[model samples]
Target chain A: MDHIEHLEHTESPANMKKQIWNTFYVLLVLTVVDIALYFALLSSHSIYKNILFVFLGLVKAFYIVSVFMHMKFERKFLASIIILPMLFICFLIWLALTEAGYTFDSRLF
Target chain B: MSNTATLSTDNKQTWGGGKSPLSISYGKLMMWVFLLSDAFTFSSLLVAYGFVRFTFTTSLPNAIVKPFSHLSHTFTEEMQKAGLFVTERWPSPELVFNHFPFLHGIHLPLMFVSLMTFILIFSSVTMVLAVEAGHRMAKKEVEKYMLWTIIGGAAFLGCQAWEWTNLITEGASLQNNPFGPTAFAALFFIVTGFHGTHVLSGVILNIVIYINVINGTYEKRGHYEMVEKVGLYWHFVDLVWVFVFTFFYLI
Candidate 1:
């Protein structure tokens, strides 16, 4: 018998229809939320606007990474490896951004 | 790489028939690495954009720019109709992509970009369908879904071409833009363009899979393992776009 006769075992998505519909559903909802927030932020200012924006942005990002990217189904160790770097980089980048803001306040351009 | 080794044993050969016995395909593995690197590249671009945005002459693109303030209200009103989001002064996605021919100020490249994002998102959905079809031994349906995926991939490329054209057009040149921060044009063009290139190449690779699928290449070869791997790549592209949409458009 030829080696080709043996079966090839590839991974399959856990729940096809459910995953697809749910991902679209969440994304649709977020887009709506974003639109609404756009109005609220525009009319009258809120002290907590920045916090709200960041919070909502994270929610959207989370769904993309977890559901769309299938990170939720990914192995724990592998997922950790991916997220660890992302977290660290975001932190360092924040510091750099803050430094950039302060640098502009100083002397001549 | 041992001669006796086969995909059935280690699950490497399904990736592609290259060296020793392996289960998965090489192309799929490489795509993951490339995507990871691309992720870092975007991070750096965003970080640099942050620096530029902070140092710019104006208060900020989103905070100032009063006309954009109007769209914020429009978006809020629309969201209220849908019952999906909270409303506020929405920044005009139009000002960002105002160069298109027919849809100039009427919700352009943003609408088209949303179209592109949805195409990729839907392709990911179809890709899963194809994989399932393959597993069920439904060759006709497998080919049907695969073909639809290829068309989806192509449509996304066409959208990108329009986007790039609008970006590089006369008024919208890297030089001028009524809206956006100083570094806004440069960062937006670079980030979005790079992502577009990735989508373009993915279309070609998908074309190859489509060909293989029609020829029943995997059937005789056994197992549609490559589908899983490529599906990952497609989904990742969609994933990245979701962030791009949020950061560049709505927010």
Candidate 2:
């Protein structure tokens, strides 16, 4: 009986749909912006082109992670579990660059 | 280390049926746990791909022309075979994939991948609807939504198939292809092909679950956590496609 009540309570337009279409629309817009950025990177200056590519990539990834992956709805622990590890990953990348750059200065020179 | 032994008793309690065990169900929580682990798995894959891509050996053969010329060569020789060759070579990825549909000959590799990206994302949308229908005990809605998801999955797979054939026969391949660095063909096959296998499995699995849903199998369990659980798996597949799109195609 209680289970039925909870199921009934869970059923509603607000809960079931919950701005899914809105999210889809936003994702669509982001995709178009991504394509535009792709073109601008190709024809524009090279200095910020790489930066633009990485920046757009990160935004797209963030949207997928937070929305489709449901990290936004999860608990704080879940958020930490998801975001904190990426920090470690970033640290590793930094270490790799440091090591690679050392070879450039010492050996390539 | 602490995350190990996931099937242990503590997890058994929390993962399966811990939301007031008598009140809530175990199957749904298990799905959540399964998804959490899958999240890590996909992250590892995307990260590993990054590691390889950053360190990609630049000494590979003529990686770009190899695929295009391979197709152009086929087109020329098969003019008798093809009856009428366009005579123009298939543009490079830097050219072909980058262009808009009607605006042919434009260099838009990222745009093409974006379309594939939307296909998977739309499928994800349909899948969420399936889960919602399951929650409402709307059997017909569930079936309808599941059918949509199946169609979406099929469409994604079809796109992937065209991609693979274009790569192997008309474009770059292991032995063929005039461009790309070393290991490009091999890595391409391994990574994208593996993801294709996952989507295929998701399609089959969704079909089975849909069958069970309509046949009143999960109805005995008194909830559609089965659908939700599979929904998590399906979403994970879609999520992986997102990164694969960004890295393999866009980058």
Candidate 3:
């Protein structure tokens, strides 16, 4: 499809502007909450706090990718192209954590 | 014989490979592929950081070093209040990243980095505005928003330079630090430095595109796809910073 046709099919300038502002506000609020949690959980050594941070971070990341990067407007195949690699990334994280745990145990024993 | 062969091929209609199957231009698709690979690179670095941090926080110290040992003691009362104990030797992020601009020796925790984060996010907003303007074929608006985006990027790079200088002044290198483990400093520099390089290149790219926009290059082309492509890259940079800020600073 042509550019003007694509614009008409997806979003007008005003609608796109609204989405942008909405995302901006959402990201700002999330960051504010993160900062608050940082202070609230400062003295605690809980893994839950870390998990919360990661979850909030992922939320922000999703908003940016979908809205700001315009991935949401793209075709499903393109979106999948971007997302499929993330599974491999999760695998890498699991591997790293496992190795780290093994090393930590060996050092301790 | 030729008519029969043509009829067979026309009926088969092999997938029209020339056109974008995803309804996107090849340029945009290539950009997505590049970004996906870049994300993998960043994930590897961050995962490595996680691994090192886990190991450092779990292993017993050979000996409690001087300043960090003293530093750990200062947090003992608060840790006790929270029902936690200092069992390992990872340097506290709060103490490590407490410097603020023009407030030498004053501890501001994460104030400066938070400001930097806001700057980068604001830049991402401007980038989207630019892309939106491009979609509307508003060249002047696109120029304005692109200029703001570039300024925000440059400002972030300046903040990062100051942060790096502060860290170096505090004797942080890849090999060693007085705070806790050397890996802490090493990963901090490597990950953030790599991100800083991205910001630098983004600013430069924006400037180049800004010049072209002003010169009516995209205006002549009948479509502002270039601006949208660059916008994708800019947003990805901001997205990566979100993770970096969380894993490196807040956690």
Winning candidate number (TM-score) = 3
The superposed Cα distance between candidate 3 and the true structure at residue B134, in angstroms, equals: 0.7
**Candidate 1 chain B least-lDDT 10 residues:** B82-91
Local distance difference test, per candidate?
0.61, 0.60, 0.81
**lDDT of model 2 at position A56:** 65
Residue A68 lDDT (model 3):
94
Alpha-carbon runs more than 4 Å astray in model 2? A1-18, A44-58, A65-71, A95-109, B1-41, B55-93, B96-111, B174-177
Give TM-scores of the second chain, every candidate.
Answer: 0.67, 0.69, 0.82
Model 2 lDDT per residue over B1-251, tens place: 22223334475743454234222235644555665666566556555555554443222111233212333334324432332212122122343333343543333355556777888889888888887777778888989999999999998898778667655654566554433443445556777787888899999999999899889887777777788678877877876675666556545
Better of 2 and 3 by TM-score: 3
Which lDDT tens digits does candidate 3 get at residues B23-126?
A: 67768888989989999999999999999887865322222222223333244344334323233467666666767777654556788888999999999999
Tell me the deviation in Å of residue B51 in model 2: 3.7
Ranking by lDDT: 3, 1, 2
What digit string (tens of lDDT, one per residue) describes model 1 on residues B1-251?
Answer: 33225423755554454432223245644655666766787777666765765554332223333331333324323533443221122224534543334543443324565566668777877876776677776778888887888888888878778876755553344564434433566667777777777777777777888788778888877766566567767766666676676656654
Measured with C-alpha atoms, the lDDT of residue B97 in candidate 3 is 73
